[model samples]
Target chain A: MTRAALLLLADGRFPAGGHAHSGGAEAAVRAGLITDAASLEEFCRGRLHTSGLVAASLAAAAALGVDPGDLDAAADARTPSPALRAAARRLGRQLLRAARATWPCAGLDLLARRFPKGAHQPVVLGAVAQAAGLEPLDAAYCAAYESVGGPATATVRLLGLDPFDATGVLARLAPATDRVADRAVRAAREALDTGVDALPAASAPLLEISAEVHAARTGRLFAT
Target chain B: MHLHHPHDGHGHGAPAPSGAAARRPDGTRRALRLGLGGPVGSGKTATVAALCRELRSELSLAVVTNDIYTREDAEFLLREAVLPPERITAVETGACPHTAIRDDISANLEAVEDLEDAVGPLDLVLLESGGDNLTATFSRGLVDAQIFVIDVAGGDDIPRKGGPGVTTADLLVVNKTDLAPYVGSDLDRMAADAKAQRGHLPVVFQSLREEAGVDRVAAWVRERLAAWRA
Candidate 1:
């Protein structure tokens, strides 16, 4: 079941519309913030801490049976970049389509019907996980892994880095995923304990600015 | 607007629907998703425009263009009036165009979906990759089939470079055939090299500048669409 869930989430064909985005790696790369594998590692680490934190939290909430609409709104509020926000909505819509096709949870259908305007990826991922029978921690880990791991893998090809070296980067990231997942689980537990109405809210601003600037650029490699 | 629900842990008690359930019924009307990828200035955008002109009348169509910095490809198609303004969507890849089409693919998928949702049904959706060097290819997850465009002007020897895009694209289009004589490109040699590299796959020598060069490509697309339906 875990393998099936992973296959559904990691297939790259799940219709989440992730193909057009490179997270914030493209912007950071253009800003000269990330070049070599070491720099890429640093950037990924930061992402895991900031944006990844938010995504994991949301995923955890969804896995714990939080309403998809609430998670979507929370994710939207947390994301700052208009471009990234737009990209997130794009991804969310695709995820919705895929989720509806693969696992038509009533909650997911409700979320899609209620707010078709602008849902984010983490929110949709959370909803899909809840519908897919995954635990909150599992969903949190999936979100964090996808949010960071996909870009790290893409970096290998984009920068022409050795595949072994790229795998090494991912290996180093495994522990970090555990840490993020632990935090997310704790947060989800806390939210549940306090009643889902008391879920914590957080946002990242610098990343949003970077996304906006990245979207405005003329020569780049990733979409966001 | 808070719509909070308690952490019931029972949401999964009921079986969730599968991803295929979300697709439109009759699925036959679903457009074929085709990806166009190649190195910079290989005429991917030109090829897309040409395909639209050649097939739009016979088939309902839409285009999704990936550009690293701007919406140039979509704009070019719009300016050329290849398809309706609403049918063209541009994804600013912000980084390597290949990453979006080959690595992540979410944004492109969303654009395609939006086009489908808005247009009801389309016969084909063209995903034009941002310009990149050889070795770039579409993720099979993102495209049903893909065409790799390489211009003779870039050098006829590019086919022998043996990159994944050149060797793996379902159809390899050696574009800008008109520039062959001027650039000293040997069309026959390039064709032979590509044929050798791709085995049974097809290759087309095209010059979008010509009146009907895109006809062969359009025919190929029709064949694929028919096969997809069959």
Candidate 2:
């Protein structure tokens, strides 16, 4: 697997429709759950263990050549909020466009044809990773890091928080991110034998509930 | 498998792999896309509304609005009844309108494509950018042509400053000309500075409050459309 491909996929400027989303951070900020770098760190940590781990495991599984159709269903089963599901598919559809343009592969084309509206983003990310000749660990790392990165960047914009403070928060979370990716890939590998049921189902109830509220908001900075 | 296929040139004569110039699977050309970008309250929405009123009788048209936060721009167009509600789509820019129109255009592209799919055979699609700074401009990949609107009330110095939007736009519009005298702006200086900054590019001085609102801009659109079809 090429390391540069991983960098390209992980770049924040990949142009996959991620800028409009805050990954539930906008809702958290509006609710005063994240006010400064320290609270932002706490929010990201909670997310890394729950949503981040789940997304990473799914992406790793997809990268390992697990059927994206089945994994998409598993993702749906795990996410309870309809708003979150829509956002995931919306972003997934955008990623599919960028990935198709960047790395044309028959599998990616087939998936695009099957889910024109989109599958979950992690499912598409994993497929994109496979198409880019990246390892399952690369996909896992991409998903895990993005899970926190989106919120960190959004916080800097929303609160006028110091950009360095946000970067520092991400730097501090690097070790945890690595551990999560390791766990995610292990779970993905196990799923190859025991089926996708072996993947993590860690849930963050507040994130899901807040996502619904954020969706219902008439005027919001982020699309959730 | 071949990993890297060369992307087709978009918005020019070459067939696009996707976005504005991308043909349907049936190999038919999509609509011409024009972008309107400028500073806040530069009469962009008013121009779009006037253009819709002026041209809707002869051609199929749709609009995609990039708003920083609220759907105010789209709402205003809707309230004006310029076109049916279905023809207007709004894209949230995450407080970065320039990024949505230029750096990463996925959302705006999606909005445009969906508009065509839903209300199709369109002759034109106007993308109205959210109010932003003078540096903001549309990506060539996103629009066939772009118009930068700067009202006389904003300041005649805007043309002298000559940022990317003012200098490089396909057409520069000095709007709210009727308010020029009230605001103490010299139209000739604004015009000369615009000429100096833009060289051969066209600039239109317009006032939507006038009887011939949007005629000059509509004529420009017609010329572009004719050239595109040719």
Candidate 3:
């Protein structure tokens, strides 16, 4: 049941406007920072390690009943780039809206109200997932799926890769997703035990730079 | 460590204000959310500038701009002094402008909410989609009404191209009509094509360089706002 919920949340067709974004893949691709599938895989792996880690940690905290506002602030601090901070908040707000419509909960609604301006996407997702009774591990999976799967799916459209090949790539990355989820679950347990305030900061400067460049270009396929 | 204490106390003592509760009791002075979307350099920023100039006196306005990489559009509006800097919110879409406005709409919605929070009871919120392709259209879920902007410079036959945006926007604005003579675009043909494409929806031929082109668009928005209230 949790797996199904994670799939639903992570699905590219969930209409959260994720299709228009490549999560900095477009800029990296254009700058030759990422070339071919190998580089793309490496990029995804790195993202999984950095931004993905932050998202998963936040999601896990939310699953553990952490306040969404606190999670949002943590996300904001973790993201050093103004551009990325904006994007994360944007995605978070949208995801929260959809989550509210699909699964209403007091905790989620309260979180939505806390960041009237905007909240980070992962934080919101975590809060909503917790409200919906998803386990921390499941929440972590959903976060990783979105952070990684979104870019991978976008790659298909941007690179014009065969759908079969894309599916193959996703299949190969399935184990990595599991590994990442395990780490996130462990991290969340540690955070919950030590208090979410004790979590360490993780920021990727290169990704931040790439996102800023992606934002400036007049011609581009994705939003961020 | 000390910074965390106050926040924790606040979180525990009181529930954060909900979005629904943030609304003014009267709610009569709600803002109309307008979405602008089209290809890059299609003069979306120019149109926004023109609208702010035309409508600022009559309406309480705010703007939410989705730029792919920078706050350039918001900065442009700021430089033009269209509205107070606080009234304008920028969402660095980071990837595709369309996603922020259409697919996800969270960032844009939050920006709208933020503007409302900062400047209560705005008459309208203009959301400028980052320059995008012909396929881009604002989600009805995001904006009360949307304008699909295409310049005559893009091509006269663009209306005939039959993209979702051209056919379905609340208002189809054929901007840069002044450039028509230079670009070899026949205004009449483009108008007719747009009309054919949109059976009943209104289409306006505008040259922002003209004295009152934006006013007409603003008037159309006013009508929509009136209808929304009614």
Best by DockQ: 2
Report, for every candidate in turn, its global Cα lDDT versus the true structure.
Answer: 0.75, 0.90, 0.75
Q: Which one wins on lDDT?
A: 2
What is the C-alpha lDDT profile of model 3 across B104-216, one tens digit per residue?
66556666766776786787888899899999998775777789899999999999997999998889988888998898999889888888999999998888878776878
Lowest lDDT 10-mer window, candidate 3 chain B? B1-10
Which TM-score does chain B of candidate 2 obtain?
0.92
lDDT of 3 by residue, A1-224 (tens): 35577667767767555665787777777888666677777878888877887788888887887766677777778888888898787677677767876776666667666764458887777777776767887788888777777777777777765667667666777788888778877877787777666654666789898888777776566667
- Docking class of predicted structure 2: medium
Instruction: Give candidate 3's root-mean-square deviation (CA, Å).
Output: 7.1
What is the per-residue lDDT of model 2 for residues B17-60, given as tens digits with 9 covering 90 to 100? 24643465435667889999999999999999999999999999
The CAPRI category of model 3 is: acceptable
Enumerate the candidates' DockQ scores in order.
0.25, 0.50, 0.24
Ranked by DockQ, top first: 2, 1, 3
Task: State the lDDT at B17 in candidate 3.
Answer: 25
User: Model 2 chain A, poorest ten-residue lDDT window?
Assistant: A104-113
Provide fnat values for all models in the order shown.
0.43, 0.47, 0.25
Model 1 per-residue lDDT tens digits across residues B18-48: 2112233333345678889998898888888
Return the TM-score for each candidate structure.
Answer: 0.74, 0.96, 0.78
